[model samples]
Target: MKNYFWNMLINIKNGQMAKKSVIIGPRKNICESFLKILWNEGFISGYKISPQNTRNLEIFLAYTKNGKPVINSLKFLSKPSQRIYYSSKQIWKIDSSKTFIIFSTNLGLKSITECKKNKIGGEPLIVIN
Candidate 1:
């Protein structure tokens, strides 16, 4: 089985490092919702399913006015080797103006504020700064 999560993030990070305008990768599970969150939060420009290949996704990278990538870094909170979970209350403890944490809750992937708003605890998947 392919690990689309790792593949997706790595592509974005590498693309930003290279200052690419776009990058393509396999579609992640619940990709639409996840990508929508990132898009709405201004982390990414947007993403679309490939016309020739449905399993693939074409991601439009976002940049600053000076031509710098909006995404600074990505931190894995949970991995296949080691999973991590946090309570809704614990979500409040996370403090960062420029960054937000993505968690896999019962409602699928949600950000810190969403998790707290829904009063749900889940595995912290990635911390995108």
Candidate 2:
């Protein structure tokens, strides 16, 4: 099956600031880490964890002053069938600091910059720009 979290994120980005937030179904550690990274980087305004019969995560989307969604595109770099791993040195060599790169490093789900800072390597998760 396709990744539910990635699908949700892509759909939200395609909607172009149409909704303030979305409620996603219960997710594992990887998905949670991805959301946390997005919030910390300001790609998303905020998120709240709500648990009832099932765990649901509410995420507030970010938008520009022109009333446009902040995210232009969101793509997964790694998948269950095909994976991409990178080293800290390779990450530092990346020229574009503006593009957000999520890395599943030893320290947990971290951005490329964070991976570089910690001097670690990991599987590249996704890129959002």
Number of the predicted model whose lDDT against the real structure is largest:
1
Model 2, residue 67: C-alpha shift (Å): 0.9
Q: Any idea what lDDT model 2 has?
A: 0.74
TM-score of every candidate? 0.91, 0.81
lDDT of 2 by residue, 36-92 (tens): 888888887776776553466666778889877778787788988898888878888
Q: Per-model C-alpha lDDT, please? A: 0.84, 0.74
Error of 2 at 40 (Å): 1.0
Cα lDDT, model 2, residue 18: 59
Query: Which 10-residue span in candidate 1 carries the lowest summed lDDT?
Result: 1-10
- TM-score, prediction 2: 0.81
Q: lDDT for model 1, please.
A: 0.84
**In model 1, what are the clashing residue pairs, if there are any?**
none
